[model samples]
Target: MATHLDLEEQEQLDQIKHFWNKWGTLITTVLVIVLGGFAAWNGYQYWQNRQGMQASALGSAVEAAVNSGDKARIDQAFGDLRSNYGGTLQAAHAGLLVAKAASDKGQMDDAKAALTWVADNASDDGLKATARIRLAAVLLGSQSYDEALKQLDAKMPTEFDAVVADHQGDIYLAKGDKAKAIEAYRTAYQKTAPGVEYRNVISVKLNALGEDVK
Candidate 1:
């Protein structure tokens, strides 16, 4: 019985060796490819984490600069964030904060520059849309009606459609195109979420243009 068992084990070992002889190179190649992909994925994850940390630190610096009303610091921090971590959401958020701070400090050009960076380089679609809206507002304030309209022409997330339309209305009004302004206002009024407080403002604009919303 022991002899029979030994023979059976030997046969199993022989079968495994034969299988390896037939396919060892192919199996090793496949395993190496799979393991290499796993290593690459892990390396990418590590790189992303490092980038995120760097962006977060820069974002904090930008926030501090904005809080202190230090325009120069804000500009420097924003530039670093944009250059090093533009792919991160924190970069876009920091840009918006820097833009708002600059705008509040009466630095319209600086504000517009920051907003333009966000509009052009933000990784998130929603952030880009927000940047476009803000940039349009700045352009409108500067009386650059065509440029404002172009900013508004960029695609926005669905949640931003009403606001974008309203901004377009403002741009048209600034341009003295009351008819187009009224059309835009009406579209904004219709698209705005029901019961939104801002819809009343849109209604007023439309009403002022002789387009009653009953």
Candidate 2:
């Protein structure tokens, strides 16, 4: 009876050993992959948090400089933010603020530079469209009519179509193409949302061109 029990125990042990020998490496590999993926995900989360905090700090610095009207400090702060955190929303906002401040100070070149950066590199589509529109306006102010038209030619978000059309009308008018200007203004009028202040403005533009918005 003792020998029979011993043989049964040994057989069970051998079965377990066989199973481990067959599947051990695959199990280990699966566990390693899962654990590595978990670690990578945690690392990514921590990195994103660090980026957000740093971006927030830099954004505040840029805003303070803008409010103080310190052109040099604004440029420095924005430069740092763009260099280090260009992918963040904070950087995009800084670009817009810098452009506005520079434009207000009659620094057309600086304004164009800032707006061009935002138009090209901003992650938000709306912000990109806004930057392009503002840049076109700056070019228009300098009588760079062809350049203004080029800026307005880029694809824009759907919400900005009317505003872009309005800018096109202004550019064509500046170029003395009254027919094209009227056509562009009519497109702006038709695309603008009714009751929006922009529609009223477009109506005024159309009236100035002696065209009725159909």
Candidate 3:
């Protein structure tokens, strides 16, 4: 009976060895792939956190330069932010601020350049739309009427419908196309939500044009 039990145990050991011999490499490969994926995910999370911190710090530098009213410093900090962290929200915000400062200083070319960058590269749809409209305004100021109209002609999100129509109205008005301006203004007023002060402003514009919001 003891010899029989010993033989049975030896048989079980041999079965296990045979199974391992058949599948050991496959099992190891599977484990390596799963573990590698988990490690890669962890590394990505760590890198994203580090990037967010760095971008936040750079954004603070931009805000400081803007506050000091130092164009050179503002330009430097903004350039750094754009070059190093352009994918971050902070960089987009800095672009808008820089454009506004440049515009206010009558640096229309610089303003248009900054706004164009933001309009092209901002991660958020809303920011892109804002930048485009602002760029159109700068073009309109420079009497680049065709370019201004082109900027307004790009596809935009529904949330920008009213504001974009309003901008189109402004462009048409500038072009001495009062009939088109009135039509655009009517579209803007119609799209504007109830209870917004912007709607009232559009109403005033329509009134000035000898047309009421339909």
Which candidate's lDDT is highest?
2
**What lDDT is reached at residue 121 by model 2?**
96
Report the lDDT tens digits of candidate 1 across residue range 45-81: 9998998888899999999989998777887888898
Better of 1 and 2 by lDDT: 2
Model 3 misplaced stretches (Cα beyond 4 Å): 1-4
Worst 10 residues of 2 by lDDT: 205-214
Residue-level lDDT of model 3, residues 54-157, one tens digit each, is 99998899889988989889889899989999988889888998899889889998899999999899898889999999999999998898899899889889
Evaluate model 1: give its lDDT.
0.91
TM-score, every prediction: 0.93, 0.92, 0.93
Clash pairs for candidate 3: none
Candidate 1 residue spans exceeding 4 A from truth = 1-7
RMSD for each model, in Å, please? 1.6, 1.8, 1.6
lDDT for each of the candidates?
0.91, 0.93, 0.92
Q: How many residue pairs clash in each candidate?
A: 0, 0, 0
How much does candidate 2 score in TM-score? 0.92
